[model samples]
Target: MGCTDSKDNLTPEELAIMNGELSLMYQAYQASDVDLVYRKYSNDGIININQWQNVSSKLKLAAYSAPMPPKIQKFYDSLKAENKYKLRDLLVIGIYLSTGKSIDKARLLFEAYDENDAKVLSKGDIQQMTSFIVEVAVEKTCVLIQDDDPNNVQPEEMAKFLQKLRTVKNKGKQELCKMFLGGNPALTELTMEKFVENVTMPSTVQLLTFQGVRKFIKKQEVTASKFAALTSLKKPTGPSDPKAELPKAK
Candidate 1:
């Protein structure tokens, strides 16, 4: 079948058939894959009122779904009627419920968006959001593995251990040190791959997909590089007299 730029020419029957196609395009667009929409139709004019209604219905269903955590359920119930359906508000709460993130943290993530405006994210915004999620995941995994609290170490001690891990050049050595610090026999055999899996498949989330796994790995590499630079800066020089070396040059 041929594609058209305008939906005004299509009859109701045609619109019904096209609804499925439009729905998929809309979903992809919502997911930050606008390239797919452009490749297919090159414009948003084809979407009809029904598609908008469908999206709203789906969002409502997702937002009001049962078996939510008590905290989330209470928060949702507490929203004023007008605020309940607000896109940014629902989305902030939705992310908190879906990712097991604190509601305040999720709200902070969405703070860039206006409270009354529709929550439309640009490509750059999506990239920033993804980076934030990956950073959070990496930090959470490192903290879990370190288990610094049980050892009677202060929070600063745990931070130091993580700093030390970042400086370690060998991935294997990092994992070994993390395990030793954690003092968990069960995690003694845990590898980097296992840590990645654990972060991607937390108890509250089913699966984060290969993209999440890849991002986790890439984030770790960047973090290590950053810390390596800092570590190099703090390296001790040999016990040579700086004055002797400077005077010899003169």
Candidate 2:
């Protein structure tokens, strides 16, 4: 005889109760009421609550599955092999800043000195990077809110989020530094690769594959070159050339 399935052995009444409990648990999850959800399910019972928890977590990930913009995708495609690590760091920094998370703690990931004795990104450097991220986020958010359909994000909601973002930005670099660094000053410094491993979230890491850091670097380079070219152009300090006189002075 074939082995019997335990689920098949449940009586009609038992099956009905199990289904009802599941339904109630799902409702609680949708409402984000963890206490109610746990009350309806037994963690130490035969119901396999861990499986249901995993399903709920996956559903939450689905909401942030918005695709990156085409421009960002192209930038990511253009990055050289060596710059991949930099791109990863950029993504982590972007995610933290966008989520209003602290970066001071992340600074512990940098080394005090490289092989050449040059220092890596200091706390001040991190603060500057955060400011740059906040500016870029503000610009992107502004464009997103102007769209007829901004990836299912409502205009009012986006406006409110932006307000919160600006509030964080206005806290100034020192406050931002303190928030991330905390009271502890002693922490082991890791390389960029190690740092990426610690900070990259599996569910959201794909969002950064669009070359966010590369795009920012490219934009800065273009702006700098344009400024240099404009500065190099010498303005005329004398009157118009005689050869180009205006119609014999009319």
Each candidate's TM vs. the true structure?
0.24, 0.28
Q: Pick by lDDT: which candidate is best?
A: 2
Q: Worst 10-residue stretch by lDDT in candidate 1? A: 204-213
Q: Distance from true position, residue 189, model 1, in Å?
A: 44
Which stretches in model 1 have alpha-carbon errors above 4 Å? 1-63, 66-68, 71-250
Per-residue lDDT for 1-250 in model 1, tens only? 1232255653332233233223222222222222122223212223233332444344443223445434333433443353223333333223322322222332333342322334433333433434433333333233222222223445565455445434332452333223222333333233333333332334312213212322334445677778879888955575566666564544
Sliding window of 10 residues with minimal summed lDDT for model 2:
204-213
Can you write out model 2's per-residue Cα lDDT over 105-192, one digit (the tens) per residue? Answer: 2332232112223444445544554454445434332442223331455556655644544544444333333333332224233345
In candidate 2, which residue ranges exceed 4 Å CA deviation? Answer: 1-121, 133-151, 184-250
Supply the TM-score for candidate 2.
0.28
